[model samples]
Target: MSLHMTGAGALEDPICTYPGSRLPVRAPCARLEGRYLAFLGGSETFGRFVATPFPALLDRRLGQTCVNLGSINAGLDAVLGDAGAMRIAAAAALTVVQLPDAQNLTNGFYRVHPRRNDRFLAACAPLTELYPEVDFTEFHFTRHLLIALHRHCPGRFATLRTELQRIWVTRMHRLLRGLGGRGLLLWLHDGDDSPRSDAPLGSEPLLVSRTMVDRVLRQARGLVEVPVTAAGQLEGETRKMDFGPLQRPTAEHMLGPAMHARIADRLGDAIATLQ
Candidate 1:
């Protein structure tokens, strides 16, 4: 079946503008000051449905300068390619790298895409005419593809996943180290499976399992997990979200605003706890 869900409206908010196809970053002076706390991730981190994202909330709570380097449809390469982001990271007192779901794929480095932001090119310059094919839409499709391919052709997918994961981990290590070993690397995932048995062999597990969680943790210096489905603040609420009409599962069913709020709260707490 197609992973694309039908019938949900794109959540509308002031935060959803693209400078080119790349998501825009709030001006540094307006949002950051002193030692930096940079948030890196995809749409969720960009605060698609909510008005104030977690990084912004964290800034308000701590009264410290924080930058939201998040982008809609952002993959790993986007993070590595933003020069302003890198400069901010290199200067931050605390850096929080919020990893997105592994379904997102990015080549080891960032390349200039007509749809991408100029900041990316400003960050990393290269003389290469070739670019790899990667999908920048639909998480489910990407995940399903990976799972199906892995299950049907184990060797290739396994090798690809291993290499990608390693590259992700290593790049992260370098980013953190470059920040002077004083940042927290936190992975934010929607609970979706257990580590071993949850492989995309045939079924979709509703929640992330301990084993898979541990594996993600193992890849980081420190970790924090927040489940949108189970966060206390969102236990019961009537507020609804619209995920655009073209998406399936509807907006209310897909991602509730309460979930985003809880994520923000959790991220805030995580940032506060960092040494």
Candidate 2:
């Protein structure tokens, strides 16, 4: 596949694709040679605004090749459905699978875009029936659709939440099993000490909870929970992120260099034990 550069962050992050899949991942990609670590997740794992994501930092720290397969706004569908990404992860020395939000996936109630999991394609029959009063046509993204649904009726939203969570667990299990026991579940949340059961709408990893994580915990090598600490949420560090003028707001919401360094530090230790 051809290599191209796109300005998703401060630098011109190179976009590359694998042989069997068209999924765009960050480049300077680890060649399929000797032992390497693989990372799979959404924007955080992709390191949207930061110059060096945790995977790259670990690459330098551990002196090992680390292939970052993280895609922007990736869900289980985007990760598991990619033959190319999965092939790399399964063969890696270890794979870090980021816990994606339950909302950005296809469930019984709605269908999301196959690759861009955050894009809402269409509502399933069940969803329409449940929200007959809602006009799903107005929605373009999963987060907006979900927020509207909850506002329209929190009671009905509960039912939808349950289903999303249920399917998230099922799909996550499938992902870990596919890794052949080399997967490590990564729970990367910002601005909170722990994942809450009643986490607000639009929260990253939407509708996922500690209990949900535990359900799939034992299936992988282990779980790495990195909660962006109270101090980490400050505005000072976020200023270090590289981005164009329009991307500043987004950069502020994303993890900055310090947090990425911290994640690299934590992951390096964990990966060392396994190596």
Candidate 3:
């Protein structure tokens, strides 16, 4: 007996089949001409939940086209090495870079699937060629390295942590410098209080302290920081700002609509400093 398949039902050779894909519409103002702004960071900057992200709000406020190059689960290595990221960095008149929590560090650069929304997976790209010897893999590396050094040499870890922090501050300074003296804003998103039982804890709150803030400020040539948390000083107000219930218990891990509006207002104030 002979059997045949035809039309859309026909079995086609894999080699002959067209691969499916869609090109991302280069976000308007990719060239950064006219009034332009660029927001670069990880998931939060990408605006996971709300229909409009803070960058879009800022774009509306400033009357400038804001190009968002934020990627979900992206670490510093990915941000620094991506050609498209670099393009956005180079073209912007103003840029906002939100540093991810120390816990999210990774050693390699990665890519985001445009259609998948918030999904991210490991990228085969090597970032060390540009960064050189810097391991962006784990946030605890410094803590562990310090412990190891202390165990091996005694009283060496403190010096080492300080040195590592200095290196990070310096690298950040250099990154800002390369933006052609454009306004560079650094926004920190951390709770003022100690990590609640429900939150994932990491790297012991490096930027939450005033000393670290001063150190970072000294190194940065043109940097603006928006402080999100303050322990005890504004406890009542901060507690009122919590969005835990608003975030879908099973699905969401970020700020909700009300919290985002507050953040947008604060961010707008920071952006106003550029003016």
Candidate 4:
């Protein structure tokens, strides 16, 4: 969340994008040298409206450097494609990767911008055939495309959603394997550790089922699932958001300060085990 002044004339500069990466990360990128901790993930890890995201907090608690490599609305594609960022994370003393929503990733039916994972690029033949009546050109974002598809043809959307889950499973397995037991998958949201849901596509991660998490666990060091408690959810209530009018709704869904503390604690525990 970038700083933005309210219409009344209050200055707000919460989120800051550093040099190097196009995405916004915690300002003053921590030193990569030495025994530093590396965190890789999406907006949650970036600490949108929350004053102190988990990475900064964890650094203070551990008396060590923790580099926050999180980007807003990041998907696996964004991190995987970022050679510089991934290179840093892979070499960190300890790495905690936040499991971003699967919806932002590019799959067989569509292509997402490598850096901007949310930006929908092209619709392949498979997607077109599934929704022949829909104009693929009209879609510019993954969320928009999925919503429109679901509305146009629920059955076809269901099938597509299922395929996405499978893709997520396979890709996640490869990601964990690549991390070499260093990757500790972190799941942060309002609900349970598992992804069980009637409408898998209804959420941000798209269709990541519990079974998918279970499968990835084989390669993952462990999955730290932190469901924000009601109290933690209230931290954003009094805080002013960096979002514009159109983005307010979505911003509300972001985890708050209380949740960040919990996440930091979870990571601290994981770090202890690693030591």
TM-score, every prediction: 0.64, 0.90, 0.55, 0.85
Q: Candidate 2 at 214: error in angstroms?
A: 1.0
Scanning candidate 2 in windows of ten residues, the lowest lDDT window is: 1-10
- Model 3, C-alpha of 103: deviation from truth (Å): 4.2
Q: Summarize candidate 1's per-residue lDDT along 1-43 as a digit string, tens digits.
A: 0123334434343443223223465323243445667676656
Number of the top TM-score candidate: 2
Candidate 4 CA-lDDT value: 0.74
- Which residue pairs of candidate 4 clash? 3-12, 3-13
Across 187-213, the per-residue lDDT of candidate 3 in tens digits comes to: 555535243333323223332334444
Per-residue error (Å), model 3, residue 98: 1.0
Give the least accurate 10-residue stretch of model 3, judged by summed lDDT: 12-21
Each model's lDDT: 0.51, 0.82, 0.47, 0.74
What pairs collide in candidate 2? none
Model 4 poorest ten-residue lDDT run: 195-204
Deviation in Å, model 1, residue 180 alpha carbon: 2.4
Report the C-alpha lDDT of model 2 over 1-275, residue by residue, as the tens digit: 23233465334545678778778887656688998889998878888767788999998999888999988877899988888889888999899998898999898999999888999999999999999999999999999898888878889998998899899999999999999999988887764535344644544567887788899988989888777642236758866666666566666777788778888888888888877
Off by over 4 Å in 3: 1-31, 103-167, 191-210, 218-251
Ranking by TM-score: 2, 4, 1, 3
Off by over 4 Å in 1: 1-23, 26-29, 107-141, 190-221, 230-238, 247-255
